[model samples]
Target: MNLQRTQTAQAPPAPRPGPVLAALAAAQFTVMLATSIVNVAIPQIRAGVGLSEGGTTWVVNAYGLAFGALLLAGGRAGDLLGRRRVLIAGLGLFAAASLGAGLAVSPETLIAARAAQGLGAATIAPAALALTMDLFPSGPRRGRALGVWGAVSAGGGAGGVLLGGALTQAWGWPWIFHSVAFGSVLVLVAVAALVPPSAGRAAGKFDLLGTATVTVALTCLVWGLTTARGTGWTDARVLGALLGAAVLLGAFVVIELRRPNALLPPQLFTTGRVAAGNLLMALLGSVWIGLFFFLPLYQQQVLGMGPLTTGVGQLPLAAANIIGASLAPRVSRRIGATATVSAALLTTAAGLLWLSRISADGSYLGQVLGPTALIGLGLSFAFFQLTALAVDGVPPQDTGLAGGLVNTTRQVGGAIGLAALATLAGSVTAHASTHRTHLEALTAGYRTAFMVCAATMAVAALLAVPLTRRKGRADGSRTPTAADPTTLPRQGRATRRTPAA
Candidate 1:
């Protein structure tokens, strides 16, 4: 009886999917929230810190640049070192960076802090996602979990504007950073308690050369795109940065192909629709990121709304996003993943076309809310479907790599799209300003951007028809592989141990 009691007591408890999902979703939410929260607060931050226009731009760009550049390295580290350990370390660093940003009184300090926060975010995002994959085997359960993840992520992007406006109106801009800091701490504690430790999958030398070349290349690309929004694309510095990025990327590709232990294995792309999925993800992100940027500007600048009102105006979009994400798995099951994604993209394109009809004297209800709601719904559906496709059939050891690759594609695509769209809008506004009123000209520019975005989405929808059509369940379901927790050796326990660092 004593032996029986001891055996039962030593057995591990069954995993609780709810808390794990909540914690991971919360971490992603905080990362995306930080990306946009600062946008509404930019004017306030500038006034408080005596920032120049250029400095203010950096304050926004710094986080994205660092986050986009180091994602691959961070994801690889999580796979080789340990996902749980990397997550905790990332949360700690993110908390500290947020606190520093909150306390910063100088432009330099704030920018630096923001960059550090990006680094922490880079570490946290892939590790959190990889852990989610570990917890849920690929099937209906994983699909549902990813649906929640998609909902919170899209919500976070829109919610940041609302939360930032409310916080800035009530207390100040500093509280935005403080709120992130507090949230990170809470997530850190929850993850530490709820998540089981897993060992590193590989025991090999780190891919230092590939890491360096790719990181610098990504940094240059992001920097160039960001600069193109302020200084024209023809500027010398922008051209130089673009050239440098191109050269470095070639070197990185060569290194990856030759190295036995590549940071990004070439075979990963050959695995079940990964390449096509990432390509579609890039297209989706291009419009999704730029839509958020121009929509807020149209509300505040042309419609003459206050920060808080503009933020509140986004409620319809957020609601639609949640609803769409909730329905994505079911929709995919019913209609099929490829069909769902293609239809969603077409839906988004139609909404953008409607938005292109916005007038100088447009009302929020007619010109903004309806179209934005449609966009929110469609984009969420596409995002959820594409994310699942991107990671499908990935190997057990490379789960982190798959997660990182998908995210990197999205961010890079967003950066490029935002820069191009912003430039096109600015030029249109400038040209129209010569022949029209300021408000009319601004509206015209915004309208032009919407038209372009719609065209892009339409093209993406067409591309999706051919790209992801393969023999599988119409729902895109697959047999569980070694990547699934149930199929993993030692029941998903790590093969080797190492410090997170």
Candidate 2:
């Protein structure tokens, strides 16, 4: 039988993104904004929401768990339902959860709402990515658009810390959640008026088991880490939770690899860049956010900076990160993705190594600025290039799942990084307090952690060269101009193509 030729259905074209893509991106901004905003307000959240040290972490953990776990499923759902439908639905749910979280009177309720917010994110992010794929189909223009999109997603997260600090200092922690609610309302309205109704198609039934397994596994691991905060890493429950998480996550991998409708294709992990890119994302994500988590302590407690000042002090990193993320793609196009990433990773590593030298009296201008800017420049070049290539290896049909995997790696990496850094800092602080002041020892712990971050990024940088330009693809993966460094392997030269959705 001859295949029926059909034009893919298009969104109703508007005179600009009056209410469509803008709304989608905004909703994304809001959902992402929520996670980082609370980081700055953790203290007030504990006091107001009755969050204990361990319990307070759940406020962040719950959202991350739900968000990370269901990401693949949400992508699948978007493909089955209309991406627009899934995107809008997710936005509405996110707004509702934000309202609940803002008014939460107890720790348990706050955690619950936070988890709900993650679910909302799970629903939205993948769908938004997929929709963007549909809206901006592949080409050079698409590549530039996607580059801008990546910057918005990344830069917005860092900005959220500053905004949250401002809001928390000026008003209260609740405004953080309320802010999301207001943004969501506007996004929802825009989406309704602008996004066309879709009779969407699905690949198959929802993968509830896959989603549940991932969620439980990540939650267990995080819970174990939280438990270790008080009970020690060797605690039986902590050990069991860690082991259980390992097994469950391993099972998730096996299941996904084997399933007919897998959450992620086994093929993706087999590629050099795909696998390596994900690892880079994981390592960088964990280490990057871990710094965000603790560096504030040095500012607030050691230097006696207020919340606003602490957030401002971080501007070096935040501002550089924005510049880095935005400029990275264009840089990669010139240097070749592999070379760009490798150089950037080296820069990041060097910065981290320098970061390890920070003392209580360490000047931000010397100790912080050089490393932060270096890391920013490096991260900006590396991540966007990797993102561009992530889906390049796959077909358009699998974009949603591919996008989910890219996202999943980052989430899991950040979680692991945060826990490892926190655990190490805790041990260092415990050991040092006997001889030195508590504050002094804590600063020592921060320096030690910075050393680890530096080492981690350095290792990743070393590995990126082999990963980006392997025996397979050439450095540019195309006719390498002086501007482009990544080439494809000779054998697959015919098969390799430019960026597609």
Candidate 3:
């Protein structure tokens, strides 16, 4: 009896889910907020730092390029090192970089700081997500936790626009960076205090060669796409960058296949619906990022709203996103994940179609609010479902890699989508400028981009059909595949089995 009592007393208590979830969610929110908070302050920042137009663009692109390119490395680092350790380090770096950005007086200084922020973000995102999965065992509770994760992440993107506008209008652009710096410090403290340490997975040496090739490949690809928006697709530099990215990517694949402990295991793609899920995620991300990009421009340029009003105007969409994310797990339980995603995509496509009809004289209430709300709801639903699907059936050891891959696809897709849509819109605007007024021509271009985004969503919806037959059981629940150890009864150690092809 004494031995039993002592054993019970020695057993560790389960972690408090609420505080852990909040800290992790806050970390994700801070990373995403930094992505868009600088947009509204670009004009002020350019003047403050004496930046040229190209330098102004770099201020935004530098962050994204670094963040997107280094995601895989960061994720792998979390797995090889420790998730909590990486998270703390990332937060420290992010806080310092935000402070540097706020204090920067030169174009070069600001851009470099922005790039450092991205690197920190890349480290934070995968580690935080992987830690979330680790702490929350797969079940209904995990589902709810993921719903909150999706909601806050979507909110951060929308909220950044609003917060950026308010901060810029009230206290100038530096305050945006200052605000992020403060938030990072708070989150870092919370994480350190509340989150428990997780041990690193036992693994072989880090895949330095695989990491380098893939990182440089992604950097070149993002740089090429971003540059194409300004210099056109046929430019020599753009072509060279794209070509270099392709070669590097090809080399990375070859190296991965040869390496015993690859940075990204090729076999993981064959697990469950991982490959298809990422493909769909890429498409969803393209539409998601494009909508946010074009919608704000429409509100400001076409409707003639100032930054503050435009920021306020996005509230409906943000509210709808919260609702949609809350509803996702419940809806997926009934209709199945694939069907839920398909329906969500169709809904978003319809919303985008409605947005395509906007005119220069359109009012915010009639033209923007309803459609944007619909799009926001559908986008949140699709993102929640797709994120689950992409990470489902992944092994415990590879969870960080799974997180990194999904994020990489989304970021890369956004870069490609934004560049293509911007170019297409520019061409349409140039053509319409021959006869239409300036506002009318700009409206025409925006309309064209919306139509294209709608079509893209529709295509993704159709592609979602195959996923149902592949991943679902006859009873409509996700099939308990061999790759997911959590699905097994906790009787003994679960054997790692390769999922069906």
Candidate 4:
């Protein structure tokens, strides 16, 4: 077996990829596009569906709740079944859900349909990432692939804002969903034709108990945080939901400890890089998602910009993000992923600090653009570096799980952090209103939120200190082993190496 494996590794590599990457990137982009595409259209959606403001919030939360909670299960399913199979299934589900959301007549129906879309996203994201990892062997080639993926992933939310505004203004709020639905169908077809079949399934039983517990816990937690923005943290329903989350999460931990085929194996967490990378990703998500959520509101309400103008204003960010992502791979090769991530975090913090000075009468060009560009650049760098580092030492069989875990942190952290920040912003606004005009009060709230974002980024940078150093090969560069099961071989049977960088 050892001799066979050595011979296989020395064999010729797979053919150069062509359309495969484009399809995978499109799949990822569409899933993330749903996250913020509706933000600018919230008012239009509310008016169209006759939704109360609270119901409107659910339109967003329902999707987040489902997406954040089910990511792990979806990832594991891809590993147990087949990555390609899961990706196709997920895309199909998303397309159908988007159709329902686009056509729904009532808020409840739309929210449910949005939840279905989230479920589809949950399934698609992990599988798509795992497939990308599978297709691209780590080295300069994988780095380039990840650079593209990272740029697309980071830019997707900003792109969504742009696309959502245009679609909503030109057509209607429903077109936002319709557009994604149509795109999903195209990408699904492309994926079916371009992506090769999965090598085989992993040997394992689905950890049903573990899956249920973690999913329920995350759902409860995200739902509670989202609900608290409207209902207040002290509200009984919010409190109960949070309590239920704690209980469920506790149960999940116990289940994982005992289960043989756990959804989130405990050993993964014991690794310093995995643990640190995930925690940092969560912090970054908090700030990133918070910025995406609030910046548009600040621009529109405070700066008196229209939806189209607001979307247009964000174009610099999208452009800057792509530039930064494109550069991160090469930068990491020089400075190491850890240092690159840490510097990017600090850069983001600096940018947030600068932006925190936002006033009631701030100029978009003067105050907003500079910091927005800086943060965008920093985010792209941090996002790609963190993603690579997070899965650095994991075995091929567990690659899907690693992808799911990191993505889960991103989604869940954004949900929880946004809630906490929103609460803080609300309190600040209310207090400032006693002494200032409404606009001034609102500016104070936004500024305070930005300061908190800066603080969170600073903290993440501090945590990254230990991660800056890693043990690599004798040349001080990490190389991918041929036994990596994530890689698709053009010649021989799939086999896996023991986990290493």
Candidate 5:
């Protein structure tokens, strides 16, 4: 008798997306809606909850603090644990937290619940992103999926600006949180029924020390900056917190560099794509945040519209953005990334420049509509491309870190932008000679802020130029074969040099 040997192998089946996508999109929209929806309800919440200035402001800040500070940790958890599992847990927690917040009778309770909601957001966002990548194998399919997803992420502020007013005026402050809570329940139901569980990271340890240090640093820095708004920049408390945060961040950098399993590996910065993407994200985030803060005042206080009307008025911007963000991929494929990104930034700058020309008598159609709509259009262009660039070329092993970095860019950028713009606007208002002059002065301040944003974003567009090649590159632009498991870690390491495509 002769012995026969046979060997057979089959490549794992290709991933297919289930109904989870629709549910995930809903969840993302709700999370983003939290930012804009709450702005219109601030005054009501303040009166109802007995919030002092800082305390009322903290209602918003608490959510941001938790989400921004803990995003890396949450993402790491999703990578190590199953993403579906994390998504479920996050949605459940978010619903509960939102319920608690909606029913809150006190500022303290509201702030606490808001923070919990943010933590939940941190969990859901990364898991959702990871799931999207896992589901789509890239190319045109992923691009379209990403275009829609990017709209949810990037165009959120405009939606918030419009929806917040309507919800707040029609339903009340609690309705904002209540709506999210209810929507979250629906998302959970959809996710549980439709999504398939995927394998988590094979073997990696969460960088607890690195996460802790970074968390403390971000929390401290954001806290100090926010406080510095009312208090002088030189206040002892602000100074101490800022200095402490700096030191902690320094320590964090040192710790991560040495650690075997750093949360955000230092080597990742070697990829130019990552660097450029994050930079642009931060700049655009700042502009987006500042827009919400000032526009309501501009429309309501300056233009003499009711809250509901103001919200309704912003619908044009939101509507335009939705259209623009959805079509961004088509634009990119035809024009190439550099031209698209630069055009967006320049358009945004021009819009702001137009806003600079606003007089006290400026009409919504004549002035506000043009500028805000352009802002919406420009932002969609920048945001979609920047998002594509951020996660581009990232190695599978570093997906968690890369996703976390993108979230971090947006959060930190918004924090910094809001702080800088609000402070400048306040200073300008103080210097105005008359009430009319004050609105004009504030508008003047906004003009300057917009110019700065435009300039910064232009530089950001330049950074993308080197990254944007005629054809998609490995890291900066997602292609069908870009997700090879073996190339993942290298993507992380080279992230800083990759630029964007």
Candidate 6:
């Protein structure tokens, strides 16, 4: 009895809920805010910079390409340099870049600045998430923190369009960047004042070679895919870029296998949970990203909705996202993360199927609102749960890398999925246009895309079934608690014990 009491007393305390969680969520919000914030301001940016329609696209792609490609390096940097230090450095870079973008006088200057902003975002995002995990001891505390994180992340994406529209119409396009810069400043201050310091740097040299290989490979792949959206996939440049990416990626694999200190440690892939979680994230990203990208096109081109109205129309999705995120922890506690995710994917797929039935003349009230809400809610359920699962049993030292992998899968998946789905939709539309009216062709294309999205979600659901069986059957078959020894800081085997989730 005395031994038992002593052991219980020595156990680490549960992480108390606090303001640090809010600051971390704010950091995530600011990082994601930049992603879609510039979308609605495109017309104004083009007019100001005297950009051609094609050139304006670079404004968005520049940031995405840089951000998506550099994420692994950034996460590893945080692990080596100290997450807090790297986070501060990242925020500084983001602020400077946003300021430059706001004050830019030419398209070249703006695009360059956007790319710099992406670099900063890549640096900040993984650090923020890793820090959140460190601060919130796992279990309900971690779940709640993740709930807020998911809400803000999704909210930022949804709100960007609305905020951009309002700022562009009322203030100016530059104000969009200006506003984000201001918010970032506030978040930085909160982080510095509120969040605790990260652990000292891990014992490893910076993997510069690995970083270069992976970053260049990802950039090439993304560039090829994005370029193919406009140019044919068979274009010589696109083909060359894709081939180069494949070769570089192969080199990166070889380098990681051989290197003593690699950017992404081989141990990360050893866990089936991490691997499967990332795969599921990719599929979820593909469906949702495709939906978000094309829905606006359908609205503006097919239904003739204005930018402001379209932004407003997305309000349901935003609200439902918050609702679902808030509830995911409770649901996962009862049913397990794997089951929650599987159910949510099926729900989202059902919603996507419902949406596929929309006509060219579909009204927001009749066709768009219900399905959007459903998708948003379903996505929210899976988003945070998958995030937790990806790093569930990882060593504390690998947290940033785990975060980076999760986000990387989602971003890359979204980019590739959107490009492929859009290409398919375009082909169908063009072929159908030959025999059908313009509206009918457009509707058919959108419907086909929606159906494809539904199928993708179903596949994700099927994959999630194995997640429930991975481990933790004795811990009530629920999500693993945050304080599980296997997930704690790296220590001797004697210090670690396998705990059921």
Candidate 1 lDDT, 1-501, residue by residue in tens:
999999999999976889888988888889888877877777788898888755765676678667767787888888988998998999999999999999999999999999999899888988888999888877678878878877877787789888887888789999999999999999999989888776456556678999889888977887787777678889999999999999999999999999988888899998877888899888877787778777777888789876788789888989998999989877776666678889999999999999999999989987898898998898888878787888878876788888888887777677677767777888899899999999999999999999999999999999988987755455664433321223233322333442341
lDDT of 5: 0.74
Per-model root-mean-square deviation over C-alphas: 6.2, 5.0, 4.2, 5.9, 6.2, 5.9
What RMSD does model 3 have?
Answer: 4.2
Indicate the residue-level lDDT of 249 in model 5. Answer: 92
Worst 10 residues of 4 by lDDT: 482-491
Q: What does candidate 2's lDDT look like per residue over 146-251, in tens digits?
A: 5655565665556677777788888888998998888888888887777665434656666667778887888888788877877898899999999999999899
Write model 3 residue lDDT over 1-501, tens digit each, in one string: 999999999998877989999999999999878877876676678889999854665776688777877888888888889899999999999999999999999999999999999899889998998998898777667777777877876777788878887888888889999999999999999999989888457476688999889888877877787677678889999999999999999999999999998988899897777887789888877776667667777887778776678778878888998999888877766666768889999999999999999999989999989898998898888777777777777888888888888877776677667667877888899899999999999999999999999999999999888863355567665555322323434312333343331
List pairs with backbone clashes in candidate 3.
none
Question: Over 4 Å off in model 1, which ranges?
Answer: 1-5, 471-501
Error of 4 at 179 (Å): 0.6
- Stretches off by above 4 angstroms in model 2 are 1-21, 194-202, 270-272, 363-366, 470-501
The lowest-lDDT stretch of 10 consecutive residues in candidate 2 is 480-489
C-alpha lDDT of all candidate models, in order: 0.83, 0.72, 0.82, 0.84, 0.74, 0.80
Backbone clashes counted, model 3: 0
- Model 4 TM-score, all chains together: 0.90
Which pairs of residues collide in candidate 4?
A: none
Against the true structure, candidate 6 reaches a TM-score of 0.87
Query: Number of the top candidate by lDDT?
Result: 4
- Model 1 residue 147 lDDT? 83
